[model samples]
Target chain A: MAHADMDTQRLDLPEPMPQPRFQAGFITPYAFIFPALLVMLGGLLYPVFMAMYLSLYDWQIGLDLEDAPFVGLTNFSRMLTDPQVWEVLWVTMRFGFWTITIEMTLGVALALLLEKPIRGASVFRTIFILPLMVSPVVVGLIWRYLFDARVGWINYYLGAWFGIEPQIWLGDAQLAFFAIVFTDIWQWTPFIFIIVIAGLQALPSEVVEASTIDGANWWQQVFLVKLPMIKSILVIALLMRLIDVFRGMEVMLIMTGGGPGRSTELLSLHIYNRAFETQQLGYASAISVLLIVIVFAISTLILTMANPMKSRSDV
Target chain B: MTGLFKKGVGALAALTMSTTLAFANPYEKYEGTTIVVSWPALSHFIKAEELIEEFTEETGIEVEVDALQYLKLRDRQLLEMSKDEGEYDVVSWVVMWKGEYVSKGLLTPLSQFYTNGSLVDPNYDINDIADAYLQNGGIVGGHKGYMPGKSGAMYGVPFGAETSILAYRKDIFEEQGLEVPETYDELRDVMAKLHAAGIPALTSRGKTGHQVTAGWLLHLAPLGGKIFDDNWNPVINSPEAVEAAQVMREVVKTGPAGIPTFGFGEAAAAFLQGEAAMHLDTLKIAAMSRDPKLSKIDGKVGYALHPVGSRCGSETGGFAAGIPANSQNKEAAFLFLQYITSKAGDQRMVELGGDPVRISTLQNNTEGFDEYPVVAEQLPCADPDWRPLIPEWNELNIDVLGQALTQVITTDDPIQPIMDAANEKARAIMEREGYYVWQ
Candidate 1:
């Protein structure tokens, strides 16, 4: 009887007033986002615009900016034929290819193998990511010392264990390239591993369990179901790593200084040397513009193909 | 409220007047002002910092030293000067940058400062500085703009002077019954003997760009190889240069296994650790080699003039401190420069493992001079233009010439072709910079 009386009182109450619609005017949403927009404009767009403008001028170090002569598109035209630019680009591609491939393969394999909760898993994870925590310059210095022919532990151990002669790891072109690649793998593979492991742990237990019960082995389940399910995550991780390759240069700069003959110079480092070392600020800016376009185009292609947002929508 | 405000204003005025009265001297006028100095992380800078307290105590001024890597310091100065921010009151510059800095009007002319009796110390004898360092490093474009001596405006004061010298193990030379090498051919023979005696013969800088280029210039200049002739034509591919290149390649075979990648630090380490019998490098390393804490051959190292090829001289390179034109405290900065490069300051620097620019310091019959007598002996034989004084020299020498040297050392390719290609590129760069009008 009490429940009936409460229901009658609720029905007798006036129908709830219609909820107010969000009155987002044209300026209100922008007002809320103005701070973020301002930050992006200052930090990102301003530099891009400045680089584009500077690329058109023939400026050099120690000269006042106003004294710089305006040369329309000459820097770009020169860059088109610059053999050094092409050589560095080729090196960047080759380095990225080897490092990314090895990192992805090793990262994913390790993640799968260690996906199960095991003793000391946290400790192993900490050790794996320690390289990523180190400063790039410090990493370069450590590796430089390690690769020293006269005093390096690497040469010492190699000689002691395998009876191999001491090698000049940074002096030779092929070896220097290998050294930088191996260093990148050491530092970044853990990033991929961490990401893949997160994705693996987040997988629905019911589907994986059902796959296991359906007579699918571990490798089969990972390849046919689990990996396919986390395809978008893999794509995002790959794109982020690809961007890192173009942006990264401090390690190479400190280790090889882009050379035993431009052997280890990435495009970014070449731009730096041109600007500071050669004092060709305008030419460096022109090269920087090229680097930006290349990176932007590649990023756009990856995002368009993978379309992580589309995958979310499908889910 | 008005009575209190009147009392406050009166007290402030009285305090200001008393402060002004206390600092009546011109040098003390800049009292309480703090000046910033940007310099390379060299031992000289440490010595300067240690002695700066004396300046502060005398003038009632304070100084902050920003020690940075050599390259970083150069870039910072360029950036700061270009922006006209007055971030650095004093800038320490390499000799190679004198032409560039002066041409850009980045450094102030010190003639007026020298004339100002209050700013210039009476006992700070400008003539006491070595003539070679004064003329080559302190003066630019015939302007005695830095450490002026009866000539054009002085632009900088020579603080550290380095001339290339040959350092070898004295015991090893005696054991092999060899005298100091007097010529390139003799050097080759000595090296051969050392190698056969089962000792690493020589170590030199082979890292690409500046290190290799600087090392090669030490060889090239003494061999009569010129970067350009009077006609401004690139002549780095000359037969003399090729011979120097060949000698460099041959010499490395007897050096440490990674001589091709060795920089000055590595080469110096190899020599100081007694792993190599000889090292051809700047005299600055000679100072370090004599430090017992840092060297295994501290007492056994012998210094000699660089081996002569077709010519009989060595390359001179070092750092100098200059007042940037954009500095707000130009007078105070000039005082600081004079203090550090002064006779007493240079002696103190010598004691602290820095190369000396003062003749008195070099001539002093002290233990420091006795240990490195060859430094003073070689100063007279330094070739000022061995590295050239053009603004574009760093680029041409490192990118073109150094790149060529790197290729020759790293690969089995013939030296002539690589040198010719480098010359072609160098000529193009020079032409583009409007440095040459003749084809």
Candidate 2:
């Protein structure tokens, strides 16, 4: 009778709910993620892989894909040896250095100054981001017109306000480079400002109070407590801005066309001119691969050094 | 019995209608077939768009026009041709694109249409087009693909024909006591005088790439500089080329402050605003410079032949229309091409302040032609091959020569090294394209 009772209890236990099959659970998670994974593979990975494959061939614009001759590593080696590539890369580096340095400095300084809840701060913030909202192409066109020696409003304003002579803003190599950099600063500084301001506002109030209780001054509180707390955000912003500098070409394309002797020809613009203007699709693809590797390396190095999420766990 | 009789009558009427439809118009078979025509957004294209309705009404074929920027048009045409079938039946291209288009087999040879009497209108006289314009634009590699007349297969018909000309401010020149310069030396003297007199002189395209190169070629070609020699050796760094560069430098120095960055539009704007004393550009600008609505210096501008250097002519540059080889509606496209470039079309173009490639239209001696006589005179002297007529010429002219010219104008660098470097680069490009014989 006891054995019969034990069997009845086992039957009443509902078969342990079928053990919640591991395979089904595992597949459910993946099935939920499958569509996005497919999108990533199609949009990003496929193009990257295709570009890599194209880098091995000597392809011209008008030729059929099959007709393009396979010339493995020739384009890569040629790019490495090419002086124009070095020049363009140097220009890109210099542009990135100047633009990023100015933007970060101005951005962080503005963020620190305007972090307090002041009257009309929202209006000022809106005004600051106006340039950011304008299209890059439109920005380029606007700057081009303003920099025109004969008819530009910039020259007119300078002459009228400062009693300065009209300047050739986009003619000389140096001036054209300066013009593009200035335009970039005007357009991108607000992006950093908005990011850094958000970071500043999100700082823990307790940490700030503790710093204040320890007799930390305004500079000390900002440099030591506030900045360190938001180091990850700054690093991420820097990384994004760096990527932008490498990727940007439209503004320069419209303004200078990498001209006055390629003084403003960024690496990306050089790749574009090589592919479309010169019809060296294979070589351009190879250059693009090199660009991607450079960007990837820089990004990985930044993430490793800063690790934005690392501070979250520590806090 | 009455139903049978009525059915027979209906059948006979249907047969008669079908016969009438077959013999109605040459393009009747292609009726209701919509064809897309792509060209750059220029005045002539606008004129074509205005007249496209007439074409549709006459043939019952539908036409859609896509007016894009010059570079965009080229890219679109190239992308379409690279496919098995193209979206554009009629493709309008710059004269410089002829060699590339032919070499890539992007254009259909129009000889078949010419031979087929029913396809072409009897009144569409190919001989009406100027010989220089016809040869420079229509014929490529001994094949005529577009316009009828002359040898080779017609690949394209001349749409808006243009050659470089010297446009000077008559009022400014008169006030400054300057005559139209005939030689490079005289041009320099005139520019110097104008500069000393506190007047800007000689606005030309100085922006790098095709703009600067086209401007430079105006001087380079007349200075007896050849882009290449008989064996395809680049002679762009020759003494004449250096002289041409020097001349360009002197001229640019006397012009606007941002001369190195000035494109065709900017240069023209400066001259038309009466700020510059002289402008060297296409003949099409002559009309624009005289237009009361656009130009501030209307009636103050005078046209002349481009200043003579070692030679006495100007570089030819213009747009042409061709039927794409991959066009699904080649017959309809050809009809459109012929209709636009015909005598009536050319007349319409001229009336709309656009340049005409037809000799009869140009010689009309009417109000438009009377206003700009230099175009007709300069047409005879236009150098068809002012730039190299090769598939690689765009890179050589714009990327190589354009860069070299930019350096020449912008820097104090010795012109010879720049020219030599450009030549070397051009030669390398040619060799890569199998233009040179390998030992």
Candidate 3:
């Protein structure tokens, strides 16, 4: 009898209202998006296409594009065996690994520690993000001076406090690499903090309440519920940082100039040195193409692990 | 009385007309034309900037100066010159680029302008410029398309030609009873003595790339090392070259606390601050050493010709002014070029803290030529081929030899192996660039 009553109630409900439809023809939506599509094509796609085209020629810096010899795949073949190319790539990978690993760990740890409402919480958050506000070039200069062997405050303080001897920070190969890695981490850790904190704060309240009611401990709740929910955000932050690591090198360029014999020369800096320092534009373009491929592959792999485009249940 | 007054008025009017005709501005025809100049932000160019207003007032041609950092100046000029319509009417280039610019046809030959009497001032004596600066900066189109030669076409006018000189502390030398070193062995002994007496003996540029290569070249030529032979083969691994590298390594040992990372500015500062006893680099350092505001030991600095090794060869390199081939205001640009490099302009350039390229200016400018004696003595020894002027030189200098030098100075590695490695890479690049085609 209850089932029959439920069925009769469903049947008696008012007919569903018809969905609204656009009165204009199909051209309306296309017209609305045309400007954005044009921007993407011109601003984003054009340079990438030009790089690909130029990579096929043996073009030097001063020559006209028409006069450039059409040496198909010669630049690419050269890149495959160029020892400097491999060395810089190896350096970039090592740099990316250390910086990203530490940044992710520290960023998440700090976010979780300060995610709650507390005394001066906003002030702490602002202070934590200050390094992100500084320009990379300015950061490089500041760190370079601080790391100077003779006049730097770092040497001064070490001597004053502990009587440690002053070291040539940028002159040594290992130290230069360490200095650059430390600088990158100092500048970029805040980005991950911002993203991860936002994701942590946006979790639905009821789920946490249910978990608490089930007698979950703080550690259990964080590990099993909060972290699982914010996995996608963490992946995205990691991907962004990885991309930045490959693209940005101004700090290293200004600090060490990829020196102490290219110990800190990342792939981007290598491409820059090859392009401007050596005046081999076509060879540099080939290296850039390789960089773009590597970045694209890494992004694709990360996105597959945590697809943000998936529906909520799927996520 | 009326007739006498009329005759006086007629005479005065005729005198006024003749004076006005005699003093007419030669550049008045190009009035209202605005030409842009691209220059490096070196001390010389910035000092020369003070005279731009004077140039404009005289020529009635407005001038816009684009003073860029030394490293960025070439990139900016290359970009401008590559365009069909260039923005820079006048451009300044360093010695290393003279070959590339002329070979690429980016510069207009000054010979044509000089021969065309209408474009050149009749009083402009091209021969008055020093042969070292003129041959290095002006001549191109020889061996490998850019080597300095007498038979080559004249492309640019030398403006800031510089040669290296050895600077030492007069007071310190007198206190120690030291004689000015004239040879490499003497230099080493004197430097070791100074170092043992608790004074850093030398300050020089070693901060990789061109900085390191430039200082090494100071020793390279004097120590009997040449980058290449007559056949364009890299001889950097030769016995004399290895000796040069070893000598540089020893010099770095007795240099300032952080000598390996010092650029020109830092090296200059070390000497000015009295942290070091000697500097063997550009003659411009002499001017800086005498500036009371810049130096702590201003009148205490002494100048000498570069120390001799197997032979005496001083560095000859600096800037030159050129007109871009695509410049829209070629005549105006040439006029600007001529005005700044003339006898009076060269003197004024020295007064305003710029290096002089003219022989007469160095001799005649008593008020500004403080280092005139030593520089004049050093001029004849200036070697135009101090470093190779080929386009491939950038790679050889920066990527191979420069990086190898950075390695050599920073590490205690075997010098021969590092130089040999650099030699192999240089050979490879030259082979690829067709420098070995004759072989």
Per-residue alpha-carbon lDDT of model 3 for B288-343, expressed as tens digits? 88788889988788888899999998998888888999999988899999999998
Tell me the lDDT of candidate 2. 0.85
Give candidate 1 misplaced runs (Cα > 4 Å): A1-32, B1-34, B59-61, B83-85, B116-124, B143-153, B366-368
lDDT of each: 0.84, 0.85, 0.87
Candidate 3 regions exceeding 4 Å error are A1-29, A209-215, A311-315, B1-25, B291-293, B366-369
lDDT of 3 at A138: 98
Answer with 1 or 3, whichever has the higher TM-score: 3
Q: How would the docking of model 2 be graded?
A: medium
Clashes in each model (backbone N, CA, C under 3 Å)? 9, 12, 0
Q: What digit string (tens of lDDT, one per residue) describes model 1 on residues B194-305? A: 8888899989888989888877788888898878876567888999989888878877777767887788888889999988999887877666876777798877888788
TM-score of 1: 0.90
